[model samples]
Target: MAPPAGYVNVRRDVTDQFYRYRMPILLTKIEGKGNGIKTVIPNMADVSRALNRPSSYPTKFFGCELGAQATFNDDTERYIVNGAHEANRLRDLLDSFIDKFVLCASCKNPETELIITKDEFIIRDCKACGQRSNVDMRHKLTTFIVKNPPKSKKAGKGRKAVAGADSIAGQPGGGKVEGEDDESDDELTKKIEAGAAQVMSEEQAQALIAQREKEDDWSIDTSKEAVAARVQSLDSKLQNSLVLEDDDEEGGGPYETFGEWVKEQREGEGVTDADIYKKAEEMGIAKKHKSLVVLVQAIFTEKIVEEIAGHVPLFGKMTTSEKHQKSLLGGIERFVGEIHPDLIPSIPKILMAFYQADILEEEVLTQWGTHVSKKYVAKDVSKKVRKASEPFIKWLAEADSDEESDDE
Candidate 1:
């Protein structure tokens, strides 16, 4: 059976007739044209309210998935996404977003609250199942959610009235009536007397302290030299313990060692990409996928767009298969998204650099551009990186289309 005229079941996969969670169906309008094209969701606020999330969340999710810029105006209650998108396409994406961010992982219940922990982790606390689950911190939206946490609902009028009544009853004689039993007054008097009785006299307190002092041994030496020796011994033990723990926690893996070496080399004078490759070869992880990721992350700086071309030979040798290509992309994502977000807007140029160098193949770039994943970075950062690469991806698609047209 079709859903009610304007609202649909929040969990579309659940076809139960009485499933209570329902949200207004999404409505979208395509506005503007060409470079300025955008899709506007006028009812975004209502839909988000029903989902118990901010309107900007779904709006931004659409942008991330579509590689478009999403913006929301709180005053106007308008959510807009760059580029023309159909309602059905957006609705499908919204379902995907809901599955990842909204529903309870254990019970699939929609009655869940997004909680941000002190350590900056996102948790979905479910009211229905009484379970708390962590949200995937890799998603780009987690950053947004952490910054703009859900607004707690204010106390209702009924609650306020009850609180007012309690305040009045708390005052002296506020709740008393003529000839009332006054059981509460009697209980309060007994509590006060019991508390008074538990207090000891000054003589009894002095006796207790004297007894404790007599019971405890105080035979240790009090000489200044003895105290200094004890302090020195404790400091030595603490320093040794900390050194052992630090050594135990240190990473001795090949990738970690290689990353450290690269960082050291980068900080020093005249360290070329070839030198980095040579170091990776010496460590016997030159062709490893993860090594590629580490190399990209460790070697690059803010001048990645300008510097990437010169390192083509090194990347060309390391990036052998699709896996290596993906690792390379992952490394770039971490470098740009986490380490140097100021270079986010330069993502397209970076991709083009890799493409022209033949370091990253068209197939891998296309697949990477279409999907947003948290394998490398937070989902939102991945989306932002991809959105910035939309121009290049679109060009690649159009070029392929032109080639097909020529064949015909």
Candidate 2:
């Protein structure tokens, strides 16, 4: 999506201390079948213990400072009860900490999902290949590992690069440079092997670096990476310029032909499909099958249709990506949101992002009417314009009445 004006957007920010706002969660204690104790400690009994496990792999234990630095904690193992001596302490600590982040818990699956809410905690969904469980460990807002590295209590004394390493590149032994010259068969074979490994990796490393740079370029300006939402911006702009000059186009009793006058009013307002289509073409919304304006107009009243059409860009011609379709639907639903709540469901044929955020909530609909009523029919801060016309609208009605009276 396009970044709003006046902000230096970054992929993420880590300049500030990561916050892990705690939430209330429910936990089922499996401490023998008969005994269960529930006490809110000073709340959680041992968050520090949960904070000690390195949030990543071959499972190293560290100081809480290092473990708490992750942008997100997968917290996948709700209970790793291996029956080892260390299992119960970790189990207890995890149970206590998870109670603070509990989204939900499932007895059948034994998964406790927690929702961690903090700027540091970016939300993610469950990808466990089953239905979303009672414990939504996925969407928790969590502070992931930042600048800190996990400190091992098991570390040996000197921190020499190879001397300190237990496994160099995961093979038990460190690699040998081997013989410098190729006079002996054994020396030649070792030299050949080392050379082959280096030669094989050289071109591959270069290719991987080039690929990563391209990805980084896209990350720097995420707007360029906005697959569907960017396409909708053009439609949103066009929808803004359109306005209704006359709502009484069906005409009054034969006093004067308001239909002809209405046509002149629309022309004067410069509301043409061609003008909309020009922007639509640029937006890449394929409109060959139907006039874009007609599709937008069908969802709202004619008065709203004319006004919104001039500004909002039409969904251009057809394209290959499904994201474009999603963008078109999302943009249209946003416009429908402005006109009325009842029209939102009609905007999207397949799926509506507006629905994802509760667009039809009565409070949202009321707020929307209050927000846009000022722009269209009237600027009534009191919201009397929801039913009664604005002063300008009332004057237009009165003017139409006076013209009829004079003709009679």
Candidate 3:
């Protein structure tokens, strides 16, 4: 079918008039005069819907390329750039955005879904060629995409419909039988007969029981001593599993040495948190903010939220100001978002744990969650970690509101 008038192929470079994927033509209106001049894309919502992207993305892309401020009003469905831009020129720029972010690199098809991975990478999953292509992370718009992820459509009903089709395909005639919907009673009778035919006879059931008895001869020794021995052996294996190079004699700095030493002590046996503090003191970095960051990344594991209470005294002794608290949060961002991303879902609980222990202040937590940064991890990873921490941040805001109400 032809794409009706006023629509163009999504890939504008392809001159195929019969292209199935099409979007509305770009439209721009110059508003205001001189210094207050702006270009309003009145049809941005329709165009973005056709391309399966948020309207703010391409609008922000224009802002980045033209060095202009772009504003999008979701309620009004209006996208405006802080300069006069011709519709033809904006259309050319839209083509560039489609090529980079919409079209599949492998098949050049517009049927692609944007996927964000746990490690903070943007991928374009193509439905045409079944290829996953990486998006250029250096682009400024990718940061915005990460912060505002696309809403995914539910597939449960579609999957059930497909399953019903597959069952029909498996039938003898490869189609639904006549009057199938009206034969519910007959269908129940047939199912009962089939179930009866599959039942085991007395002799077969006895044989099966005998086979099960013959295969159940093994037993495990779960005595206290045996369990303790197994645990000790497992601990020993875990300790020797990771090999850290001795960078101390190779001109590594005090923070590096302290981090490595903390990792070593965590892996080895019989090293208390007090011993770690004493070692840090001996190295003259016990109160350093960088050392606290290193200690956070090195000592904690996947069970950080549960185990953090035990080390509160050590952290309390080191963290004196907001700078130290910010450093600690940076360490956690690297630890959970970069090193062990399986802990990403636990980020809110982890932040709440820190807040309850007085390790992270509410002001700092609110500030950190407000924006995404690439200081500790990749920008995408920072966004994911912050997104996961939204629940705790919201709770903090509600608590503050309640306090204000009580003061009134």
lDDT of 1 by residue, 1-408 (tens): 555679888878888866767788899998755665678898988787677677788887787677565667878797887678999999999998889888888899766666543334456656567665666654555555654556532231110000011111112333211211356334423522332121233564465456445333312343557644544544342222111112424332556556655655576644655467656776677877778767876677788887775666567667778999998888887778877788888888898777655467788999999999987677899999999889999977865654344236
TM-score of 2: 0.19
State the TM-score for model 1: 0.44
lDDT of 2 by residue, 1-408 (tens): 433332111111212222222222222232222111111112121222222223331121111212211111235332211112233354444443333332222221112222111111211112122222222122111111211222311112211011111111212232331211223333423423333222124564475456444432222112334523433433443334232224535222111111122233244553333333333344333432222222443333434533432322222222123443333333343344444545433332212122111122223333333343333323432143233213323333443443334236
Q: What would the TM-scores of all predictions be?
A: 0.44, 0.19, 0.42
Ranking by lDDT: 3, 1, 2
Please give the CA lDDT of all the candidate structures. Answer: 0.65, 0.27, 0.66
TM-score pick, better of 2 and 3? 3
Alpha carbon lDDT at 407, candidate 2: 32
Q: Please identify model 2 stretches exceeding 4 Å from their true place.
A: 1-215, 219-361, 369-408
Model 3 ranges with Cα > 4 A deviation: 152-408
Best by TM-score: 1
lDDT of 1: 0.65
